[model samples]
Target: MPKARRKPEALDGQHFEVVVVGAGMAGLASALRLAMFGKSVLLLEKHYVVGGLNSFFARGGRKFDVGLHAVTNFPPKGSGKASPLIRLCRQLRIPFEELALSPQSFSRIAFPDVDLKFDNEFGFFISEVERLFPREQDRFQKLLRTMEAFDAYSPEVAGDVSARSILGEHLQEPLLIEILLCPTCYYGSAVENDIDFASFVMLFDAIFRQGLARPLDGIRRFLNPILKRYEELGGKRRMNLGVKHFVTKNDIVERIELDNGEIIFADHVISTCGVVETERMLSSASQDENADDVSRISILESIAVFKKQPADFGWEETIVFYNDADVFRYERPDELTDPRSGVICIPNNYRYPNGEQMAEGQLRVTCLANYEKWVALDENSYRSQKEICRKAMLEVALGYLPNGNSMAKELEERTELLDIFSPRTIKKFTGHLDGALYGSPRKSRNGSTRFGNLYLAGADQGYVGIVGAMLGGVAVANNRILRGD
Candidate 1:
């Protein structure tokens, strides 16, 4: 059962052992872990709902998912195989079944001429890749072996290595390399052309080794349990409260002042807000050299609800990575207006824990976007631009659907609802400056700052995806707050 969220006004002079800012996955995980350890925890969120980037919004009697496409790093429930997320679940005491994870049927990566489908099973994925690129089978194996080195609980301390450099070493085929990099980089690329080796391997292990899965009942089904468990352990959550400033003494955060003018004391403060926002709260006078650069490129997402599923039109795969150009350019163009390459997800194709709801389907189409361009648009111009972009993006998305020609007709005819969320939406909802989907390229520090008790979690910590973000919270709680190591 989900616990009722309390208003921030209820907490005027509260004190806790630990105060966690932000109610995203990382903040939720941190509060849960700390409460499980018998520490009095106060979790705060500026938004009314939880999950932040991964959260959902409701409109016209329909609930639409936001940033969550799938749980990329899915650990099987009883397979006994070692999974990175399993450790976090164990520490958090969250039963795997509570997640209600449903593996993807298959995912398609499409280029100008080449189209490949990756199965959900690891063995099947390896077999399919080998079958498709038999000439480079040996190279594939070597790359897999090399990537395994990054399967640890912590980030690799090795000097930064780019994904491009790593792929070039193993394979000579440009298309194959682009295919491998497309999904991972799109999910969490800090750099324009390549991601750091640690991020590369993390995404590889999640999408390639472990495969993708989604909760049957959407994000609420997954989050409510954690919130329930936290409340059961005497943890408290105050919603609609934004941290205004941190009261520090001797380089340690001693208290937090909310935007509502309420001050609360805590021995330690863990911030799930990204580095820039966190730095702003610490003090306006303090300077972080990388604060401005923390946010990478943002995204533009269009969600279309239909009375019928794409599978009805012969589209079987749950996700399709679509590229129009012969040479894949992973970054948004300097102009930031046109998006030639993007991801298209049909959430209905997923195998739900329960029977399928073949009633209505959703197509979530996303592309890299420029936060600056989006935020600068006037009201009338913004609306006009969104409509134009939506139509263009829809045309491109239609081409990837099964029997795309006819599917486009069916979609236009049966469209129940359509909504476009820009970079500004992300920034407004998550409070991440510039609507950055992934935080700083710089890896998160070990949950510590100049102030010994102040720590960073969430995107600021350099982990992406729901599992990675939550684990970041657990790691920080264990290393900085709980263990004091």
Candidate 2:
């Protein structure tokens, strides 16, 4: 399909200065920022809700975050000087209560015998790390400092330093390496080759500062406000709306064609979809070479928002499990059983006594899954895919519970498939390049994407994380708006 060229002509329709596609956090953040700056922005989300990954679903009166479980970003100095997320929260006047994670530890790393607890304060966190890896204490501290430096490293301070450069090679603790890389690997990157040090730092910051806290109602509270805020600012959203492809002329994108055969024009199209899909949608020429090559990147899945009753309601806050560095994600799978280990993230157990909301109890389990297989099936086969996923989750849940099977059977009968979050899902729903949850790996030290006006953001450009994604939005928008693209 040929792209319709911008005529340098009169305004059509409402004349939006920017058209944001995909209502995920990145897109929502970008659009909100632009709107606050007084730009006439029109935001489009395929889903009914405004927040993409941040949205929630309700079943059995319990609402769980479909994508976002927790949040990071410290509250900042004072009222009006909070961090970006805080700023958005305040600007929207969304009243939120801050709750610290249970056990006063952010994450408990349990290896075969070593039980290391991580905290919100960086200094405390490092001290704990140093205690666990005493032999390499000096090197471990240096690694922590280096990662923190990467978090605060301004583009101006970068001063030609290569992004691919390692922080330091002196720390050789195999267990430390596993701990450091396991979280990064969840971003779908190769432990050795996929990420830059900046990404690692950003992720660490997120966990440390934003000790996992769910909203009062659940994950929906966070997103519902953001969606309301987006709409309040006059953002446009269409549920069940799907974009088939985009049209570009020369170096500029002119219009996006929806699956319903309608064309929506934009001065600029900021898609949350990834690079591979962007190339396919915006490529003016007619060749379809290497399309599926981009299609086949592996996906991470879990029984996201797995609902169940815990043995003890207080166990909700304390993640009572035996997950070392290798317990969760350790394999390439076409289903959940591939890795053989699964993670149970019990949010309600951390804090709070059971009141009226406590029906039986709230136990949330997420297993690393192979989401690609779900994409291969037709609608009829989806029911069977759900069964495979349910069984896989049950096997992993049985690791801790003596009565896990009966509980698992109860869940299998009631749980919903929710959504299939694959590369293609990210492509269609979020519009990220390569179905990248985070953006592509830096790939080179020079930091070039080999194209003009085409840039990366969210988890693509630098790192992949809550903070990384936010900073990615800032970086790409800087190139386009701040730098006069």
Candidate 3:
């Protein structure tokens, strides 16, 4: 049966105070906050569902976070302190939980016979690193200070600073170098890709702090309530309505035109679609200008999700990798240029619903494939190529795990590609420039994407995870609408 169209009980505003386009997490969160402030809000989604990039599915006997493996560094609520995302959730009645790992839950570096576990807070992280390599204690302290300082210093201040730029200038240890590159898989970033200090710090601080939380019942459980509350607050949403153009009146976006030929007029427009797509909707430009903006994106992370039994807790972690010593070479080879990464997880007790089980296990493998690679292909060609890419990824999987062939077959049969939002897909569905995850994260140019009255929230800004996206969502609300506006 087709999913029912869930229209709002009341959508009485002819000209809403806030008009949000793209009902992804960021758009939804922005709409919720705006509605709470007594603004009539209308949120439009191009897709069938609401979660955008922040969503999940049930496979095996467990639920899995589709793209977000785990989100860290979100400040938990309590007496005196809280992170901005947490505060917004509370104010908007969005349910969330702060999860603590076994201190050694992240970046447990293992090379051959030696292993160094990264656990605890900032201080503890330094202590653990120092304990492993006493000689680098003093150097480690400097790294911590750098991270602390970097956190306060936004990308707006940092210019063309790649991860290598900061690491090369300050710390230079082979062990530490490996540690720095451990999670590059998250963004599918290559060291040469100019991941400035600010971006590097965002990823570093998150993994070190909040550990990871497998949303209460995967992302669905976490977001459904928020969506429900959005309706209760009199916010409106529509799905499968691909926004095609933005109609500007009085120098502001007055309404959005959907591919379905429906026109929605509103007082404000919040675009969670992305940088490239947002511009396409508003830009009256030639191909040359569009091409230049395409290269500004730093990375492209393609995610694949499959239906299977969920991996349980205390097992091999959700983001697991069975890397074969023989296949991996520190030096980048032509074959492995688009680095393939691992994520083996089961929806165990800690992350599953009260009765959810990992009957059909779930797994997702993400890699950084070039947008140009896909965009260059014709539609039919691209469709055929996606399967080829999947097969190649499966081979890469075999290279990681022992029963590589069998596991690859199982996943190949069940797994489906999720990162269709490549540059072209972004152009097609979301209408982005390069299908950039987070609008141009170039610290060199737009810095923080501070356009006059225009803002960004989604994977394109801040960090890249559930927590980061939520925080970005709130930032759009706070910086664009809430803060004394």
Give lDDT for model 3.
0.53
What does each candidate score in C-alpha RMSD? Answer: 4.4, 5.5, 7.0
Number of the top-ranking candidate, with lDDT as the measure: 1
Sort the predicted structures by lDDT, highest score first. 1, 3, 2
Off by over 4 Å in 3: 1-14, 56-65, 74-85, 95-116, 119-128, 131-134, 152-160, 184-192, 295-315, 321-357, 375-433, 443-453
| Model 2 poorest 10 in a row by lDDT | 441-450
56-172: candidate 2 lDDT, tens digit per residue: 655545554555545555442353433545544444344444322122224555555565665545566577777888898888667666665553434533322322345337477
lDDT of 1 by residue, 1-485 (tens): 11112343455547677889988999999899999988879999998889899888898788877888888878655545377667767878887777878888899888887787886678877887787788989999998888775543464343256878889999978878888888888887766767777777878787877878887668887789999999999899999999989877667776678999987877678998877777777754465545646656788999888887667778778898888875777665565445688899888878885676546878889988888888888999999989888888888877877777667877889999889899898986788877878876655646656677788998767676788889889888888777742
TM-score winner between 1 and 3, please give it: 1
Question: After aligning candidate 3 to the native by TM-score, how far in Å is the CA of 103 from where it should be?
Answer: 10
lDDT of residue 245 for candidate 1: 90
lDDT of each: 0.79, 0.49, 0.53
Q: What TM-score does candidate 1 get on C-alpha atoms?
A: 0.93
* lDDT (Cα, tens digit) per residue for candidate 3, span 1-485: 11111232334444556667777667777788888777778787766666765555444444445445555554423522335445555756655443221122344443444345554345565676777678877776787787776652242444345666567666656656555555542442322334546656666765665444454445665677777778888787777777777765445554567788776555456777665556667634344444444433322234445565433212343344323331223322233125444333233423444444544444444444556666678889877766666556657644443355656566666765343324454444344455444454431222133234345566555444555556667667766676666
TM-score of 3: 0.75
TM-score-superior candidate, 1 or 2: 1
Report residue 25 deviation for candidate 2 (angstroms): 0.5
